[model samples]
Target: MKKILPGLLLLSAALSCTNKNEKMEPYKWPDAKAPIADIKPFTRILHGDTVVDNYYWMIDYFKKGPDSTKVVDYLSAENKYLDTMMSGSKAFREDLFKELKGRIKEKDESVPVFNNGYYYYSKTEDGKQYYKYCRKKGDLNAKEEVLLDVDEMAKGHPYYSATGFSISPDNKLIAYGVDKVSRRQYTLYIKNLETGEIFKDQIDNTEGDAVWAADNKTLFYTSKNPVTLLSEKIKKHKLGTDAKQDVIVYEEKDKSNYIGAGKSKSGKYIFIYSSATLSDEIRMIDASKPDDAFKVFQPRMKDVKYDVVALDDKFLIVTNWNATNFRLMETPLNQTGRENWKEVIPNRKDVLLSGVDEFKDYIVLAERKNGLAQLRVRSLNGPEHYIDFGEPTYTARIGSNPDYNSKTVRYIYTSMTTPISTYDYDMVTKEKVLKKQQEIIGGYNKEDYVTERLFATAKDGTKIPISLVYKKGLKKDGTAPLLLYAYGSYGSSMDAGFSSNNLSLLNRGFVYAIAHIRGGQEMGRYWYDDGKLMKKMNTFTDFIDCGKFLIDQKFTGKGHLYAQGGSAGGLLMGAVINLAPDLWNGILAHVPFVDVVNTMLDESIPLTTNEFDEWGNPKDKEAYFYMKSYSPYENIDKKDYPNMLVTTGLHDSQVQYFEPAKWVAKLRATKTDKHLLLLKTDMDFGHGGASGRFDYLKDVSLNYAFLFSLEGITK
Candidate 1:
């Protein structure tokens, strides 16, 4: 498993500045995170072990809690993974605990948490639920404690599954949602963490996110109860007593009772964003009481819809529509018992506000333009200036807790290209410093690999951007094996970044390319619109175009090309293989959303009806006709297709395992020839395979091996 040390060691100490309000400059990237970044095939650290490039991420030293140092060391050291090493859990946990006991003084028993980072995990065998908690044993990397026994909490509730929960700022009050399966409604409950006292009587079905009031005398949360046909009702829970006071803060009586309430750090006003299915709006409400005195802050342009991010108590930053792309605007909030408003930052067409966090004197915004996200800071006192933190080597995302403190300006920035690192920037000094960077067990070298951006036109004449990476000196001849990856659905953007395993593929002379297709927001909402509903066929055609483009550009031969995509993108891969399998040597479909017509037509399906907007509703005869035309599973025909590696998870809640399971079964049963089709399911994980990082790497490696097998690369 990959053991990335705590994020302290990965950051390069460098500072650069730029003008924020000045004319935009071309993309100038920063230095690589590592100086000697050769494609690290493996890394060995601390304990006696080794980690392979493919499966290294499975070891999560961060989960070890405060003193993750030892966990990191153990993870940095490679462990045995032979048949003998695959013993039962008890022995494995015992051995791990024993090895860690010397470094971690805390005597908590070892427990396995889900590696996806979602607040859900189950045992390997029984699939019983467990919760993650921590104890401060003076070790920053304190051992994590997993509480598995939920029989008490599950009593009297048919929907004993955990829904949503929040721990109070002081870590005292724990509020959680308990869904009742029959009513299809979720009830909220409160528990005192310190006393271990449960207040079940205070449970109510209508509550959503629980927000603590300024005085802490009452808790406010949004709810839609009493079988309301109107808007969601907001309610208050008075602490200490088994009482719930219901108050209708806002009501629309519309089909969309969707309302989200968020309290500003100052505690004077609460920002409420409400929308139906298509568009959304942001408004403000008085935190003190329920009244018509609530004021709505409408966008300057009604055509320009938006979402709000509270930059500070007085200013609410908004992301507004700029054609298909989104632009950011900030307006000051006047919660003075009177309706008042003013704009702080007007809309700028050239830049997209990618990040924002409020500080003592300034608000920081990381804006993206021309495929690059830059950090810029604006002060109420001084002119706004771009914090020339330098263009990150990869796509950078900035975020921070809403609690406005002196240190709140220091934001946690992470990228798919770089390890998660924390940085502190002084609003006063206009200076920046790296707080932490992730540690790599293996050494690195920069000159060993290269990345480039290329463009290709789709069958529909739309230009598709592809990010290409491979060893620096690979010849342009159409001989090298190529891996074409695309996830062109759900408005998701596949960003450019550094991948430890992908780099391994690059080092192995395989050209890795990401096809920025129609369904993603890379180009904007229109791009997504073009690939969804009846337009879904464009996604596959786009992939075909990309593969053909690769051949035309002489990047690789038709026999050396492989196509890969998962989830919605899996649908893309399956469709492309069906329509033009000759273009690819092999196909890797992971947790695919392939059975569209049947699945989307059924209202009983988990995500079917809700996703009708993204994928056309198959319930309608017209939509059914449209979806059937492109549904991969339904459209599968007896033809010569690429060798396929089909991967799925038994417990996938999003795209059910039955889809892939049934698709593979049908393909195997119906296909005419010996086209090799492998169906691998990691019975443990859900939509994400294998719980740990290393486990996921193993899955990916096996998948790559399967594709490479088609190219005669595997034994």
Candidate 2:
């Protein structure tokens, strides 16, 4: 994970001149007292320790709809109270939203992807709330075929998502899934592109993806368990058959493992995968023989995770078996066991073999070396080369290339200061053609902004990476308000990509930074290992250290520093406030999993069983005590905490809305300071708050407005 570059870490300390138009006048917020929820006393005995939970009744609201329980009433009350308190910033929020919207090219279309005989793409109109999926035959100039008008489909609903637009191999039929309620349980629908006829066979509670068989009429789809929402079954359905008659091809009895099915690029076989956090098993089925039983290619083994793809007669496997950083191997189709797996790409302790994409004569591998994405193209017999992005710091990844016989490889590349650009590269000729770059409707100059890489020394002596970007002349002068963000769990690296929307903050003198903490594999697999289970607190501490490092460098000082994180990162915000309440003036926590102990202890919860490996199973004595020590809800104290704005969705399926609802309630009751503490719950959406593209910006505007309100900014 270590590599050397010349002078990549140097940042100039020039001060940017303040804009007159960005100046603000202080405004007084209406004096109001926040609502206080009545807390009923409750207690739980775990590992011989007595825990008292005053807001325990919040869980009941999750089990039942908000309408049937007092939870909905409490959430509504909180929303009303927050709206009233933030009334002074309403117009500022609107102006911010408008400015954000103006940056987007309203009538924008995606780059067309060629598959089979059609070039397909999705476009959004100026006034539409959703995309319109369309395609053309033979050539780009040919007459267009409207596959699905999501705008028309989402017309009457407050929340609507259309997913998995998989076309049959025969190219005559389309299979897609729709979810009106954002709980993510989609209903499958089949449409005949030739006749424009919609079939009546509807499959409910599915994962929204379908893998088509060689026989166009038959397809395989994964189903979700009703309670936990985990994908657990794969079933085969005939195009014209009733949903009740679909055959259950495979059922995963292990509740911790997630199951899904996909068709190979060769279109010769369908692969079904059952995966847990540390183990995985894959099975294969011949696409031509639709009714044949799947054969297990590898048996499930603990801590030996692998993914499979097929060539003509051999299977390429990417696995972590005996390879801490992962590697690529190949095995004959008939000899599908570990002993028969021969190394294709030797394991490099410093590089992570992320994934593999196959073509007729070449294979594209997505690897991570030195915390940066490296896309490599290797020929079957000729040569191997890495695509040069020609930038010091940026993100580049393999994009859509569905045709197995094509020589062109599609990829996307971008950075904190660069617009998202797409390109098609010729594997043989090494020719790169630019397809498109997202048009920031209002004029945007890349030279007006600058990005830099910085290192923060953690208490453990590990150097953490921080990606920062700001207006060109921003100085390291302890004056500009900084918004530090990090999500240091699940090994999910937060990519530092360009966003026209974020310019609203940059132009307003806010420095944005992403902390590449230990929980992310950005520095390799060991980086993630250092931040999970017993060492989970490192994720929180690293973030605090990064914030201080920025201050030490004079980017921002005490009380002027601001932080934001959602979900797991929200937990970061919660933990930091408890550990160091003097660090910031205000913070935002969205859909936080603050009640970690209780949530993890209950096996019935949606993500509980599946995440046992990440956050240890609390049933064990050692694990129970370890998690309870850092859980935000249990760590609340009677001291001053940072001013906070917490948001959640009433229908959130992942981190239940009640987690934040309960945390805020406990904070209000325990803390002595009269700082602003607000909760805004969206009554319509789920874990991902808004379904519409433009509508979600309003939430972003609200968060910005909340920060601006404290900073004395006005519209």
Candidate 3:
């Protein structure tokens, strides 16, 4: 049996003692009333189901209606309530922030990447919020030319993102994009590197990437829809011409498909890619011919997704045509069609061919086997071999290998106990050199920590992988606190990567574990297929099972186990709490997508149409009921619930702020428990809070403080 702390034991007993028919005593707090959102009583009749929502008006901020002020005011009230309730830990939060921030090396420089006759890198100075993008010509010892000083450029802006630095083929000019607001809509600007002159031409609402044509005077970029913020059109622009007159090279007809323009690695062709959840199409034109129309490489096919990579005489395709696990196929440049594609690397049942990095003489394939990443180097006409990571479980992916003529390939490797390390491997000589490893300013010792890969059997008989890390002296008596985390959606695998911030938890005797659930591609394509759409329930159940497994193994007691997830994972947190309300001691949901049915039903919302395949179209009736059945917001009942700290940003473009805000409003009014249900909203930021490096640590510190306060740990 697991030993439980007195406070946790009391909380658990209160929940276990509560009966469904009786009103349970709410846990007493610091004597502050949680925000009560005004009831508007909105009715929705969909698929023969009648639903009335009291906090539906919370979405008025996005609608820009009269209730917009009310929405903001309500959010402010919740923020104030959270502050007052957690006021006891105010000083602790600040100290925790400094401790987290102190681990980072204040002055840092990235490994310079050699591209197009220049070695480019970004370096950050101590105390600066951002970095300076600089490049050296010929070699590393050459004079440095600072392209963009983002620290200086972000002077007056609260949220500024500078990205997509595209240098012209001639290397005399450069184009970049900037977003002052956190909405992800970037304004493209061109600058003359030779004379340091800022051009008058500017393109607005672009996806940020600017693909330069061989002529150096023309550029191609993807434009986004103002409302949905979806990449909708590819346009061509001349150096000195007005953006209004830019020609529309191609426009995506299907709202589900996102389109983007990019140059081939060989610099021989400019390709426009259109992709959806299960389908893809590519169009290409010669880089020298900017005025020429792009020819279709492959027509979009249902349930068949493929990506193209250009080479000297052939184009490689990574596709799922007949293979559930993707395979590599190649076709001649002249015959760019699916019919002409010949299998270069046949599909294997065990290994998933994720991607390929092309080069002049060698090709590096990124493969995944048994839920771990691997890099395979293959010579065009020679032998192939997998690069040994020397670890049973770790993530290894092909990094930057831009120069086609270089025999060496760059790859990144990291494990739960290992810091992220970069390496350059000679594909021909089979030799590898470690370029750099992440430096933790406050010394770290791998020997002081223990990492383990465990398996938890799900209810459906599937073995779910769990990656965990803790301090060396961990006891299996279940007295320690454990935090289980996962993001089981979009085929995104939550691999075990090192985090300096996680040291704060491990050092405090908290066992941090990642549940490699079904929805992720960790176990290959079948794993993802079994956890999405109608089978989405597997995701929630898998996470619940993982937590139970941890408890069964005496890792932690149910009252000491905490759960966390963000975005889609937040949905997981919400669902798990509803399905197994008494299972977790505390939950931290970051920008949670709790309102699933309503958000999926509304096509006007950004990313809704694009996600129809992932979540299923609710208009079909079946998906609507299925989604509502597990939706966190819809399933909230008058029951004892775990303490939760829900966070969101006012300008969140991904999972909108209204989802969490409304969910919290409903939870406060509905839940019987008085456990901490605090909602922290970053009013100035969006989905990803704090653009600055040190600023994000503050949010992390607040989260740590919440967990510490619950466990009664104050440093």
Candidate 4:
């Protein structure tokens, strides 16, 4: 008879695979733990010009408390080992170069917008900012130079900062924003990218999102006073020796409304959409004066109830909500004026319009009819000629603007089960060619990984979806360590996606799961509406239900389970830990919004009032009672809870570090056992613990080490 050990038994066997001779010695764990450094109240995190990409990571850290901030670059020396981002080793750079070169070449060339070849980073040293742009192309030595010196650019303005920049297509002028003492209000500046000379004219506290018009001299941006979504106005600014700033368009002032602006393809017209209260009705604005570049569009869209998708000189695609389902409706640009409206694509009951892109004679619609989301192109130049791009293996999500080169349309595709991969679909050839594939994060195989959707009944008998991922072959034993994750707030859904880092856990014999609870839009708007304000406790109970369901199915035991969530989900994690602390072995709360009541009470905080709709205002008695019910900071009680590791950032403007600090302090004072409450705050970084990639991974590795330690696997 042949005997085979189950996965749990095998994992336990593997964890003990260390040398017996070493195990014989007394366990030597690091005695000294890194102390929590004292942080200043007004510390700010720094961000790099480089986007958070695959091989590169940007991190901000404070060597000396809040007074100084430094940005560090983390480059993965090799794709083989997902390790450090910042190291003074030359061998690491060589490995990084080899991996980066391989990945860069795989990118689709049709979308020749910007390459992640150069490093653009700015840092403030000795109260002066030093900006540099370095590019390493081919065998060419690294072309690195100072792009701008902060002191030379803005002369008189005390404490001038440049951020949110966009470069002209010709790469001549750089449109950067300069903020005063208050980061909220900023003025736009036109700086010569090469000369580093800036001319500030359209400087106003109300100025917001800006984009360069094709003319480069003309700037189109959204501006508003007090920066409210309700009263935002779109304006145009001329940038030259002598320029003018004017309100090319103005939206109706309504507290409960939101106005969004978009430009047409030909630049002949600018489209403005008005949503009085709900994001439904979209009105178009045609410039009243076509000759003046800073002209406002006429305010009126035909009573056609729909959401704008794409607008061009020829056609406009909109997601129209009929009596039942959301459908795609297209109208000719010529007839889409104030009183004239004709539907090119009429409303269909079953189809849910996702997105659309327009070319000269054709319009491409990305729609989800059944469960399938595919791209469909319709040519209006001829009769109703249409072509389907076939059902993609995964859903195809189109960006705001997809690059079209000759006869090819390039876009990206990904699904709950597929890794994000880009492709270029040839319009004429009707062939789909793969452009780039994400690195095949090894250590685990897809065939061994299995995902299933389960609905668990909560305390209120409401069914919540739980996405579970684990190794395929596992016995129905109550010994497997389970990591139940959830983020149940702000209508943010924990969608299915691949993570190279998560692969570490799967290989180490852990079942990973996400509770798609209420207070999120995973299912729909109603899900979020149900779990916020007075009903916020539902998030906690739903998470508990997920854990209970796993135990009921004999997948995990009480001491072998862990609950984790971050941000709003962090609130969920903290609440659950306090409510039922004995249920889990450990918990990880990352940049959590735990101090709910106090934080929401102050309107001065960023995103506080804006979130009033989500979390009821604490001022009202009814709201106060309900909000305090599940707020982690307000509800800490005397109990022997599981070990918890809470993370926060001193520079975090969104979820202040004080919230977690207060919560941890109270938890320590109240809890009976020495419930190892570790508070790690990145003094220089914001909500994200670190700015660079390697720094993030290092923290992540430390977190996992702590978690694994609680499971009897310590260094």
Candidate 5:
């Protein structure tokens, strides 16, 4: 600990030390010779096609043996090059980091959520690197009990994360999933709350989530496949038992489906959801009947998707059965099949039923219309009404409403201009009381910023939504710089919510835009459907088209536009650049999944087999040709590319670091122009870099610094 402390403190000092002056040069480009990765050509044959990859040896990064491995050496060289290149902006980056950190209240606590007999919340002290999980018995005025001091837990580890935090019904024992490797695999630990003693029982390599059964001694957890890292089995573990003795209560035979177990809001049942990209199946086990078998609530059907929420004597189901936009359905608990399900809320093409939450008498439906969230609340037998949120571009959904019998339901509201606000809506009284809104410690005025919702037409004539925000006085006359961002995969909506960190960009005369492109459910199921599989080109093309529209609409000039995305979004950045390399002045791709064809073809890779419905099976010749056609790595041409900053964690489990390492190597070898390409690999951490709250800001600062340097906005 003493050995690591000095170096860490020095690094902190370097990052926190800001420049006294704001005036600076437009940019100081990294002038050092780029590190060229050694080429060892490897041949890959798939679907009767042969390809040679020169950087294939980079895959040795995952191999165990020594840090001296050639792969490690190559990555280290790149890191050194990055450090050398960005050395000029170290102080500037630090200044950005300090300012970004200043916006956040260091000593902050989350809204207390009442559950069972306790009100639980997490708090971060001023100097702490992590939060402390705490709870109060019966009321808010009661004495506080610390459940888990994550700062203490994180003391000795470089990377630490608590995956699942669950407590026994009696509240005597707390079960949590801990991950020290940052690989998304966690080990379950049981701790006695009263005695502050951790038990001997340890369950490893799980999905990190555990659902407690009514039988206080029993816990059900999902296990991840060691090879693919996909949740494949649910095991029943009894307290104090050897992990080897855990029973495999359920096993998902389909490798494509991910299985998970969770207790219902009502706490009456533990539901196991097994799903793939286009299909879903749910099985429910009564909480009281921990020893009984789990009964299938609905059989899996191709293209069918649904989630179950247990109610008093029935189950509320949000499903897309014969409904592209999804609808609400209910069936008696005993009649658990789809045939017995009856419509509660019929499907509407204009609206997408995203999810549902249940209270004793009230049912809250999280709906989305025209790319905005709408929460509809109603009683099982009373009038139904939509919770009004007047913001044009905001994200709102039910928050932690754990107590099933409570009359008040909590929901969080946020827009690009509003800090996160939590509200307690009394379903009975039809009144919303603001619980809390995050405080941006350093003076922040929402009025100083302006937000706009714009649309761009895709090649197919599909209208794509783009949410933009910038400083109030910024002009749309094409002089301003813009950073366009999007993640058009997995049907995840990139909501236009508040980000205190992003204020750095908006305040700097930069227009920040989120392209609600296809592949995201922003415009409902069809939006996602049109962007994936054989139609996946829409994801890339839509992003490109959005950039063109922004340029044409004079939001930003052609050379002033920037682009950024991570993980799958990183894939977007990679593709858009390949499709329209001249559109962006700079591009940031973090932990990018750029080697599409190769990655999808490799079933042993995490999420590859499971995401076949998303990327499609390369074993199928049709899927192979289509993916290969647009794969960023495979499609790389000897053309000038954007000034690019690519980042990855050496320990990344999703989208292996080698993907970006290899992609950059190819770019350096093939690109016609020397448009600055920088790759920074964090030796520690995984897909989600720097687990520490404030510590993570360093990466953000570097990214912002990179963008600022390009635009010559050093201040």
Candidate 6:
């Protein structure tokens, strides 16, 4: 075990002092000895670069090697240390958890989505951990039939996930998927709604989606590789037959591409999609003819990604082949080749065509313009218009419109200050009706909050959007604490949305902000293209600039500002800390992916091969050096770092548990700071913390307590 450094002694001494004028005493963390991990030096020579990783043995748990037990012991020790240090906040953490959970409506039902001849919805009970999937046939007042009692099914499991509920064409049989261990490998099961009996045919190791043919007996699902957990093959299964006899319909030859099976909304064709980051190819077969061979819609082209939506006589294609912002094209149902496609909506430099939801009389286009979502409704007869969300910064997207014959289109709208709202709009009348709005158990008045959309200038002269919300009448005196969050990777935009848990911070005088940095498609494909690969530094720099901008504007000072991100965004948190450690007082990284070079270099990782286009593969010398340059674990130095709370799940398959474990171990040994560095690993769950909605708030409460304790805002 390593001895405590002088810097840690200084930190302990400083904890005794507090502001004399303050009303409450400053939080004094327990002086418990942090567990020091034993270093087992491991060396690797990659692209002529020699590196020695002292904590590399932490990866043994996943490999099931002799050292696996040791890795678990190390992680357990870290968890115990965290508990000991935070023991002072036990009651405070409970209060925070209850406060955050209290705002959520315990008994709630989602707006019923009318599909085929039935209206399907899920409702949660007061004290239950899960909801029940129920449906009503014929009309909204019809008799309710309970399909799945997830609360009962999840009784004995520590983690449970039920998803991908697909009903047969005749609506008599239902296909669903379940994951008990939270590793994302779901087992597909079929249940007869007419007779409350589950079939004996159960298929394991699937992607959790099952598309049914018109025959109602044939099911198509994507199979996953047992080792890497990658979606590798599409297979067909007969209702009563053994899953072992399932025929492989399509096997993805390219390891980098992921494949999935789905039926079109029109129920006319079944599609098998093979997609990578930059390219994709689609195959389709008639849903009525399950035994027929599938035909390719279009051959895969380099750097081209196109999704198809089947229409009555034609197929609509949203492709980025010749348009950087993507354009809408159409081809006859029979002639689905690139050469036969004709442009319908020409690409605009300012607008990005993200998706299309087709209906009988109209098609709604999900678009992004200037970092905000827009729903454009276009009639088959040629008139088009966009739905007005009436917020400066908000997210608006097409919701569940399963009924093709209905003229009303459903959409969801939410902003930083607004609760999620569902609306049904009549395309012809141009009017909308509010179907439902999220109810906050405790009274919530939007007038008590102030939401703003501001821009921060990046180092390269690009303007980055910053959406923030705080209690009304906030003083710009740089005395308040602020939490800044962002997720900038894989073209996934972090849009402004409402969170009930955020009220805890706001009510406590904390300003919550989201930095819309590059690497996300907020500003279109160009924004994402410029923030990845060689330009990945832009993501970290943009976040730093946002932090500086907030401080410059007197919103918060350097020592009171906090930053957070998760998964790839967690990578963002790791990079920014290494780049500008003094810019933040605290950081909350959930299931962080911090070991960039090592994780990317190893192809056996769950998402490494699939994300080669997002995070360049390290096999190439250029990619290796670039990734190594910013990897948080590799770049740790003898410098002060902000207090941090890092979280990961031991069973996580996406980012893996070892990445953060190795990262925290290295940071603890190398950093010169005496500040808090904590790691919390949920042994039973995976990438996503908990299976239950309410139970997840415990993790959130822990994070809030950490931030609050640092700012001396204990409840």
Index of the highest-TM-score prediction? 6
TM-scores of the candidates in the order shown = 0.67, 0.96, 0.96, 0.68, 0.96, 0.97
Model 4: weakest 10-residue lDDT segment is 73-82
Candidate 6 — worst ten consecutive residues by lDDT sum?
A: 12-21
Q: What TM-score, to 2 decimals, does candidate 4 have?
A: 0.68
- Measured on C-alpha atoms, candidate 3 has an lDDT of 0.89
Model 6 segments more than 4 A misplaced:
1-25
Superposed by TM-score, candidate 1 places the C-alpha of residue 528 at a distance from the truth, in angstroms, of: 3.1
Question: Where does the lowest 10-residue lDDT sum fall in candidate 1?
Answer: 11-20
**Residue 631 C-alpha lDDT in model 4:** 83
**For model 1, how does the per-residue alpha-carbon lDDT over 612-674 read when each residue is reduced to its tens digit?**
667766556687777767777767778777877777654455676667755765565557755
Tell me the whole-model lDDT of each prediction, alpha carbons only: 0.56, 0.86, 0.89, 0.56, 0.88, 0.91
Compared with the true structure, the alpha-carbon lDDT of candidate 2 equals 0.86
Residue-level lDDT tens digits of model 2 in 1-715: 1111111111110112232234465557678878888778888997799998998888787676443468878888899999999897888677677677666666888999999989999998876779999999989999999999999999989999999999998889999999898889999999999998999979999999898999899989998888888888899999878888889999999877889999889888898999987889999888999899999998998889899988887999999999988889999988999989999898898898889999989999999887888999999886999999876678898999999999999999999989999999999999999999987654668898889888899999999989988887777778778899999988887767888777777877778889999888888888888998999989989999999999999988896789999998888899889988889888999989899999998877786888888889889998889888889999999999988999999888888888999999999999989889999999999989889988999999999898877766554
lDDT at residue 512 of model 4 (Cα atoms): 78
Residue-level lDDT tens digits of model 3 in 348-413: 999988899999988999888899998888999979998988865677888887788889999998
Residues 1-715 of candidate 6 have per-residue lDDT tens digits of 1222332332233223322214444579888888888989999998788999998888899988879999999999999999998998999888777666667777889999999899999999877889999999989899999999999999989999999999999999999999999899999999999999999989999999799999999999999998899999999999999999999999998988999998888999999999999999999999999989889999999999999998898999999999999999999988999999999999999999999999988999999999999999999999999888888998888898888788999999899999999999999999999999998664678988899999999998999999999877778888778999999998999999999888878877789999999999999999999899999999999999999999999988878899999999999999999999999999999899999998888888897899899889899999999998998888999999999999999999899999999999889988998999999999999999899988999999899899989988767
Instruction: For candidate 5, write residues 1-715 as lDDT tens digits.
Output: 1123333343344333232223445686756999998877889987779999998778765645233398888888999998898899999887777777766677889999999999999999876789999999998999999999999999989889985889999899999999898899999999999999999999999988799999899999999988789898999998988999999989999989989999997788898989988899988888988888988888899889989888888888899999999999989978989899999889899999999989889899898899999999988887999999887898998898889999999999999999999999999889999989998764568987889899999998989999989877676788788999999999999999999888777767788999999999999889899999999999999999999999999989987899999999999988888889998999999999999988887777788888898998888999999999988899899899999999999888898888999999999999999778999998888999999998899999999999988877766
Clash number by candidate, in order:
32, 0, 1, 12, 1, 0
How well does candidate 4 match the true structure, expressed as C-alpha RMSD? 11.5
